[model samples]
Target: MSKIEKLLKKLCNPAYKQNVRKEELESILNHFFEGQWTFGEISGSHNYRIYHPYFKNFPEKFGPEGFLTIPVSGGKFIKHFYIKILCRFINEIKEIEK
Candidate 1:
């Protein structure tokens, strides 16, 4: 498994679920997708829209169809579950390549 796979595996693990640093998740995402963060329609929410054409059909086309719920801890931390949707897509892409 690749490093991303490993990390995603860890992130997606139910038993290991924990709050993640928002910036850390974004850094990992920046490595795989082209996107930027914007405030979401939901109050205190944010969305990371993927612009990379190759990723348009990601995660069985669930691609970029969600928003990140508000971060916790003064807005520096986010629940991994909220962003699990994002990682699922990124992982699906990685899995398909293999």
Candidate 2:
């Protein structure tokens, strides 16, 4: 697999997730999707969300409301939760790109 894919796979695991920072994952989403997606806060820095065109391709179980929660108050460790969410998101982006 490619380096990005490998990294995302590692990040998918709970053990390696805590090492990720919000800025790093946010950068990946921003850079990977570029103009095709939108990023914004639902309520300033206290809450956030990401929207992408490829979300339409997601499976029914993933939900059609089409939003991912970004936690902002649980310290750095909480970012680990986000890693799992975004890793799935990035994986979807990868498949869509292919």
Q: Give one digit per residue, the lDDT tens place, for model 1 in 1-98.
A: 87765776788776767888867676666667535444344575555444444454544553465333334454677676766766766666678768
Query: Model 2 Cα displacement at 88 (Å)?
Result: 1.5
Model 2, 1-98: lDDT tens per residue? 76656666777876774656556565565666555434344434544555676665663733585655566544443466767777777777778678
TM-score of 2: 0.58
Clashing pairs in 1: none
Clashing pairs in 2: none
Using lDDT, give the best candidate's number.
2
What candidate 1 gets wrong by more than 4 Å, as runs, is: 1-6, 35-46, 52-73
C-alpha local distance difference test of each model: 0.60, 0.60
TM-score for each candidate, following the candidate numbering: 0.55, 0.58
